[model samples]
Target: MSLASQVGAVATRTFREKLGPEILEVFDKSYKNFTDVQVLSGTHLLNNHDVVVESPTGSGKTLSFVLPLLRILQNSPEIQKNQEIGAIILSPSRELCNQIVSVIKPFGEKLNLSVETVTGGQKVEKNVKMFKNRGVNILVATPGRLFQIIQHEKTLISRCLKSVQLLIIDEADRFNEIQFEDHMREILSCIPKQRRTGLFSATQVKEDDDLVVFGLRNAKQVKCAQERNSAAPSTLKNYFTVCEAEEKTSILLEFIRQKTDKKFLLFFPACNSVRYFQKIFERCLTKRPLFAVHGKCSNSHRAAQIKGFSDSSNGVMISTDVMARGIDISDIDWVIQYDLPKHSSWFVHRAGRTARLNNCHMSRFLDKHEKVKLEEVKVPTHTSLKSEELRQKMIKIQVSDRAILEAGTRAFVSHIESYSKHDCHIICALDDLNICGLANAYALLRLPKMRELTNRKDLDQFERSSIETSEIKYLDPKLEKQRGEIMKEKHEKKVEVLAAKEKKRREKEQRKMKRFGGGRGGRGGNLKKNENLKRKRSEDEDDTENDIRLLKKIKRGKLSKKEIKNVL
Candidate 1:
């Protein structure tokens, strides 16, 4: 039988035997729409076989993986044993991890399974403790923190994973980036080979096969029709305009002001650009609630901003690529590319944020240069090209030296700084050059004519001489010291404030205890000590206020005897 027919048979069996009447009723009641393609793929995954489910944003892909996984867990005797972690899901963004956990929790809970989210923005220790205590059956996390946990507290996490049978990596394409591949490798290494792996992505890149090779060796490919052709569920209209950099802000403002009802997301290339647009938006649209979220914001602040934006459908959220993945907000009518993405992948991901889950109507704005650049590049395919051929092709293409310098200088500096103190400084230097050369070896390697000194000894000697006489100034000591002092003072003040707050809180608790008739020698015996602490706090506050007032007076050149008396 064909895959579809087999999937149909599985679904029929599942409905009759596995789901029963109650679950079917709940599923029917909660689900507005269901796709057969997802059902078939999900059934395949539930059978403990590796499967890749490639569906678009809204075709019920989340439920596709989730429901079958939950059903598998429900049927398994291992779940009854109270396994610490029955399944592991890895997503690219914290928001996505949280979203997956949110979806899994209700289903898992119904089956008496616990679900927990682990991401980088939160405390690692708390998550570690949660895993140790067997509080979670399904653990969803980003790659970085997950690797860190595996590296540092492997025993604690491994127990959970040894019990884990299902591992789903959502947004596989995003996670398989060149920068994060090593971390991804490290994470996959920790998982037991016996466990089943599933890779899910909205847009599958060519690297999916490599991902399969690394872990999911026997993985079955399930390419849903959602990603083929121009069948994107959303009516995402792409448009371009030519304008000077100075006029871009005015145009953006005018465009935002023109929109009356629908909410929008404006994307920028960097955090600085996000802030710049945010300021312009704030000034232009005072009546509307405008919020910006980026990597620069504190974790708590970013979470709050994202939550607020997600909750409200009428407000605009301006952000960088930080919100590109994992952000699930319904009713984002428009997505403006204020700054075009540097890479086609980023552009895809950013655009994916909107037109989510089949809710259509997205509009993208681009400049002429951005349009030209985007047109010149092809969307990344799931095929690898020869490295040398790729290098030659890149050399043939004209890229600005400024772009190369800007990118390479940063990497070069980091490489140099990473190994300056090692005794093998010459080797380190050579390695740095080699690392940098990998980007454009044909162009860069020949520039430094030390290629003839291929012998280790000669290379080392040449490197040492080259580095020793290098004119690069590492860092200004005075500026570094000033920064250190500023940070130290800020930390000291923060500690002092925290201590004061704690003292006040304790004093308040003691007062409550005394007020409830638990006096000295009773439950409130500590009241006197707390009262003394409160007295000291009041005195400190008074002194601080007086000092502030005196400073103001001094600033105004009106310092008087009363200020002096208070200071004394």
Candidate 2:
């Protein structure tokens, strides 16, 4: 069949007119050309058959399923009650959820289909209110938020979704890895068993296929040539420069300056890297806006950055794995990996952001990868503790009073220090309690909790600049454990060095206490003994000098025998 004929423009028009002109308008705006995926997915969903779509990034995957679902919802008015949600779209990240919402909201409004977003980092009570208090014909959500709402308000969401004829899981491959397999299954159980399901993603391994099969019932699969999964886009020019960890940031700065005219999507392994590099860019004193998106940013904040970056003509966005999935931002001139990507799949998705929609150029700056989080599984924390509740609680209690006190001397002292090294804020504060003046012991306490270390004590500039600047990292249990073991020899070597240093320090201090009875670092007994030894040594030296002088005086017969004997 001819490619255009296979694309079936007539099929698109028929759905458009019946659905309304809004559908056709959004379709053209959203996609570059009516690709085969759209044609095939559009036709398949129109046929009321389930579908599993595997297409490359920017291949109109969103619209492929979206357009078809729109057509379905448009024609299913009789089936959907007023205020009943007709379809549910589940994406993995808040950013992706909002992106989907942006894409379909206009079309949805034009068609009188109310669209609402349900994702984490927003108030659950508010989202629950959205479902129960008002009309939401379409719900776009992340797994955790979706699962939470359903778990708590199962009846309400289920009732709203009573007319939910379609369930679309965007980026099924990533969602499958979303640390919510059980929650996903529970969510599936809550939904109508026969709702037409569409699973869309760019990368689907065997495990993904297996999980997808659970939600889909003999769904027809529509995909590009198998090569598309692993292949970079033909238009994309892939280039990489491998440098030592220290040189990565400098090289990145140079690359961004060299490509100043282009826009970019720079990817980091984690959110901290994004924030850390934002600091780097600020230090470089760039004129352009530095857009950032990561798990740490509020949902609205992240969504705003994504939109603002997308609309801006020239800007840099540094993001984490959140953007590495299926986020379509047009006119991205370059996709820079400031750090090594998580894996092969990561390289593909991170690179896919650029060379999109017949191509454009972009620029960015980023840095710092600590060892990947996976290393935490095999090795316990240096403290041999897994949970941070105590650490955080301990931190909280220590800072509680100081965090509250505004004008107190202790607070002033803590502010000067930011007191992170203090074991207990209470003890540090009390020990330093001097009515006369601020206690010198307060030096151990850092005043404000939020103060950042401006200089590196243990690491060099390059090493300290890393996002994983912390001595430790956060790791989840099954989600991370299942990924397989990490090569721990490097970390083991590091631990050994630290352990030896600690041991050596203790032994040296102990010996100081024993030898002199005590040195400045030792007990008072060691200090007193050291003083006595110095006095005795001086006396012996004086006696020897006196005896030599007395001998000289005797040779000259100029000294009394009693004085000489007294000197001896």
Candidate 3:
């Protein structure tokens, strides 16, 4: 048996002996056995020791801390149901917080622990009211919403936090980022110092790390050993395919067609690409259920899409890295990365989406210009080229639908901008991008006005859409008519604003002409006269200073050669 499997067996044995009867019953029904990291981390956590768990994604990091904390809460004599917060889990994103809440709520219910969650998507007033009336024992929250509540409802929430025995910072690596550090600090300060803290991350944390702000007290560091030092689950089969920019969608379509029965999570670097491709896939893959979500989506929209896709037996979810961490979706057959993630850590997190409950596969599309050495990573290559039939279909779709055409251009531009900001610049250099091919891949109607494409010669050779962009109409007649009316109104407003600005400019110029005797030469001559006067005055001042210096030198009976030359 493998080290991981052996560890799991040992963990299962330990859990049955230590965990409460209710939890153990649920555990046996839900999970076969505890994972390697869970076993190592749970031991320290159950002993009331602060822990820092550094494990790969899909290695059951969530349950590693969660189960131990739940047990602690269950066993504690001082804990009161719905009257005090026993434990609090801090997550970076709303989806992640919701996922964490979902996992814990069921277990909390089984254990008679009341679980409550506060995230950005819901109304703050409602959350506040819920906390005040419903109360909570275990609170799962995003840092932003939690911090807001603490800032506003300090007395009530802080009082609840005083009873918090455990604090789990999920995706601790993300909190270490500059954007979230301050919020983490504020949230940490609010929670009682006496509470048990558990810092969990998929990425390996160094002995010397940025997590010092959270201030773990002699924290037991638990890191799970993996095969080949991979940050992704050992069960995940990673693959890559090198293709031109335009060929990406075609290849992705072909791959999806080949695996029609499999559930897919497709990652894009930017939200616009997710939205664009989601629409494209909706039209092309008619039978398959499709959902698109990203950072830009509204709370209700994101929740709906997440729920819709989660309930789907075989569906495709196109999204940004927002869904990368802490989302616990089961039976995901494949993770298709259409674009390289900005950070290497995100790549592992994306792959971790699959292979959670069982072995799964992940495939990434790399532009030919990207020089990442896949051989070194042992990622197998998919050798097939882009399909011409799919390419023709994509072109036809873009040409016919105005919405698709516009979205394609925006997505293409956003991709270029996103690509330029990649952390691995040496491997995915912006200068090396095949702009023409990428534009072709997007089926762009015409090149968008972006600084990246300035003075590019390759675009000359690329075939653009024959139909004028203005002539293109949206597929829905109502939408097309509304768009036309809005465009006309905007144009009229713009013309009026421009005319007003022109009138003001003419009036200002007339005043200037009148002030300077009403001719082009009059303004120029006055400006020249002023310049001469200022120059003459400056020279006179310099000479006067020189005379004073010369007299002073004479008094001292000394003069420099440079001073004498200027005087002469």
Ranking by lDDT: 3, 2, 1
For candidate 2, the per-residue lDDT at 380 reads 17
Which scores greater on lDDT, model 1 or model 2? 2
In model 1, which regions exceed 4 Å deviation? Answer: 1-25, 207-209, 227-234, 353-568
lDDT of every predicted structure (CA atoms):
0.58, 0.59, 0.73
Please tell me which model should have the higher TM-score, number 1 or number 3: 3
lDDT by residue (314-395, candidate 1, tens digit) is: 7888887787764667568767675434444454566663422110111122222112122121112211233334334322
- Order candidates by TM-score, high to low: 3, 1, 2
**CA error at residue 470 for candidate 2, angstroms:** 16
Per-prediction TM-score to the true structure, in the order listed = 0.60, 0.59, 0.76
Query: Model 3 reaches what TM-score against the true structure?
Result: 0.76
Clashes of each: 2, 19, 1
After TM-score superposition, the amount by which residue 316's alpha carbon in candidate 3 deviates from its true location, in angstroms, is: 2.6
Task: Supply candidate 3's per-residue lDDT for 182.
Answer: 73
Top model by lDDT, which number? 3
